[model samples]
Target: MWENKIRCPCSRCSNNKFLCEDKVTEHILNRGFTGAYTIWSLHGEHDVGQSLRSRDRVEPYASNKEHEEYGEPIYDEEIENPYSRMVKDAMGPEVAFNYGCENESRLQRLYMSCKTAEYMTWHVQNQSDDGVLKHPIDGEEILSRLNSLPDLPFGTKCGDQKISGYGVSHNWVKNSILWDLPYWHMLFIRHNLDVMHIEHNVFENIFNTMMDVKGMTKDNLKARQDLKVSCKRPELELMKNNGKIFKLKAAYTLNKEEIKKICAWVKQMRFPDGFASNISRCINEIDYKFYRMKSHDCHIFLQRLLLIVFHDMVPHSIWDAITGISHFFRDLCTTEILVDHMEALQGKICETICKLEKIFPSGFFDSMEHLPIHLPYEAKFGGPIQYRWMYPFERFLQHLKKKVKNRASVEGSICEAYIIEEISSFSSWYFEPAMRTRLNRMPRNDDGGDVDSQGRLSIFIHFGRAFGPLEKSRFLDEDEFYAAELYVLMNSEEMLPYIKMFDEIIKGDVVHISEDELEKVRDARFVKWFKNYVATRMDEIDPRILEISHGPGRMIMSRPDTPLEPVTTVVVS
Candidate 1:
């Protein structure tokens, strides 16, 4: 196939011929190129078959080939700590911090103003005819209202002034940087009730109740049910087979006395692998335990670990409500941002709130902890919940805070370290094979040294960038393969020598990026599938330009699905 494309130097067709597209293909191929890749295999370049990227990356390399590529890193870690390769559990929260820096940037201040405006607007618009707020108040608002003229949030509250039928709990909003921003008057964005804060408050409410902590216990305990009959499980085939009915024991319940006993019990309780030690410590500290527990500790305890704890405790309806809310949030945090999905997520949150209302007395929700109900609309209309999530910024703060090594001049230390990191990160991009990733080293090919899977020096463009003509040359990491496929498709060539030799075909879909082309696809299901398929496969497939066929079934071309990129992976709970 390559030989036929070469222009004949013998001159029979030289002067009349234009030396078309075939000539270039012929020249590159027939020029006696040393082609080790003329043959190929789906089994891959592994000695016994595996990609150069190490398998069992989290544990240890699975075989010699994997060990050759990646074992050194694991070995180095083990040299420092013998158990490094084993699964290690974290004792505390890692994703976010309980507190953030007091200082705010000008941009942050602008966002705060927008937030304040939006919050005030939403409440004003939703206020009832009776002059009461339709929903619960928040901490910031309470702080603002209670503040004196000389206090941080001045003018918001005077001595005994009330707001939305509630008295302020404190006097401090001076830390609210937005109060002085120029755009404060024009802002109309919702005050972002951070999900982390909402979750923390809810957990505290439940925890305080569970321990029957002094001044924190509620008469209408949401999780209490010692005197009532609860829902029963349906009779199953086990009872039918025995020709007898087996009764279930009453569901667990606790009173003030029982809770106090459990609090003592908790001091001696030993949790399994996943729990933090905070659960046990809270036992003796119930009087003011809220002061010790950080937001994330409370968050994890209530959202994930509480379900197991409740099995041995009470059958309070409030506990069920809290569990429902926790489950909804778990879904909210991880769900992909499809419009339909977002709407459904919002619906679920609303339902959870309704359930909360049913379980708790009205006054129980009259605090800022209830502010999260308003967040769903914002999340649905705006984007994925992560876009509004605090964890990323909170996690970054962990990195930023670490940069400060000197106490004498903490700000200077942080600034200098930050500048140094910026310079180093920028300098890294100019290196021979720039590492755009967080990985400290380059990828391994089949060789002992860094290279592409094909054993060539790999030129990776971090997060993709464009260069060269024909558009496809700017790659999604397989330019050569992409170009070859395009060449075969557009050129009317019978088959390329490489293809004929290997008898192989690439096994993935091609997505045309044109909006016009996508609009032709009208089937919602196919569009959704195609989108999700593309989203999930971007890392695996050759992601350059065009040419598409969907096996004649999938594709309705208008729209679809980011964590790097969000799909439907649920939080395991």
Candidate 2:
């Protein structure tokens, strides 16, 4: 069995405790049930006997030619690894994705399952132990010891592929579909290590560091010193002119007063409606206020709630690092984002994490160390991080469990629920969707009529960030609609003829508008908005690559007359 990473047991396996598709279906089909739900009739299953039966006449059917016919050996060394050729020939190169398994025993067992090995493999006169790379491989030539043989009796049916296993038992070939191995391995990469686990652990470490829990509060003298120096203000007006730079104890971690102040600040700040009432639920459930937050308060505290509570009590670097990591993950989870952009964001994020090390107690880095290594790999896999994440699956599992109305046979209840749900969904595809999906209800007199399903558009007509939203989009202006049509045409590289066609269509218009004039107006408006946004929120801009005006009138103003973090005029010529 594979190593399960998440806390979930059922997410990795099923009610029958089966993780591997091959094993579970085979076991079920062997029961000889001829029902519609039997393994032979399972449409979702690729490896069922019925599915494989049709593929026997295919051109790429499993080749059984001897190793001598190909003139290429599976193993490099002739004397050792003799069974490697026989194993490859039996397994077939089509299934070469998991030709190398993470567990050497499984790979060995696979080899041992083959009946073609004529030479001595494992346990050859006690020269060495069975072949395994227990330690990290670095500068070693002596990997060839031997593969362990299977404990199964010699003449069992599937002990050899030649007997029947190919088309009679499985479709999709004997290829390793485990973890997208073919895609990653050929590119010199292994399967993606689940990033959700790494992120949760890292966030947990950050939360623990802030909470200043036991065992972690030990004197990390260098970390303390580094944090103190980084956090130290250049001067304090309250401290007299005689005041000198000095280290503060518990500089990296918050003290009691600071926690109280943070709580006071959070309480004072206005929040969304019912937020105050909702927070009361936390205290009522946990028996403690946010001021007295506990160390064991899970990943959500670090991921979401921390931003609301954190204030000036902590150093800006520590705050930025925490927020930066949170932002990085949130960005990765977005479906519309490009992979190249994410990889770029990952680099900037790594820099923030490196800065975070300065604030941690010297050896406290080991607490969340694997995070940086894992960050780069997540970008390699296509689509959003949520597709690879366990959170959504874990949440949906609760929904699935809720579908089980009967305690006696939960699986059967779930199947019944799923079939009902599937039938409803399929019916919705052909019928009136608004009635079946959005609900059959009378619209309010005040509500807009015949609204588009994809929500309200901006003032600029058809322009919108996403294809769909909470409210229906409307075409508010004719010019804006044409402008949007032009925009799409330009993006598709067919704008020239469209512009000519538009010019031809608007023959009898009372007011004449040229294509070039419309483009010029749109471009100017876009540039204006871009400049204004940059001017107001330069600090919030990612990577902060904008050049500050350190030229004339850029005096470093101090005190009441001139507010700190001076807002200067940006000259964009």
Pick by TM-score: which candidate is best?
Answer: 2
Model 2, runs deviating above 4 Å? 1-171, 175-184, 187-189, 193-195, 214-249, 264-280, 283-308, 366-368, 438-573
Residue 302 Cα positional deviation in candidate 2, in Å, after optimal superposition: 4.9
lDDT, candidates in the order shown: 0.46, 0.45
Q: Which ten residues in a row have the lowest lDDT in candidate 1?
A: 564-573
lDDT of 1 by residue, 78-165 (tens): 2233222212332333465657554323223322333233443443355333222222232223324334233332122122122332
Cα lDDT tens digits, model 2, 1-573, are 334221112322323352454554454455443333323212223443754766755523333243456765545674534335535665765743555655324323444422223222322222322221122111012121111222322322322322223235443333566555433333323454555566666665665567554454433445545544555532211122456534345445677676556545544443333222223223322322343332223344555667545546577777777787766666654544554565687687778767766566544666455455554444443334545556677767888999989999999999999899889755554454355352334432222343445532221132211211223223225454344433433443223443444445443342576668766644445333434545787786532112311111221222211111122212111
**What clash count goes with each model?**
10, 5
TM-score of each: 0.36, 0.39
Q: Name model 1 segments beyond 4 Å from true.
A: 1-189, 215-291, 432-573
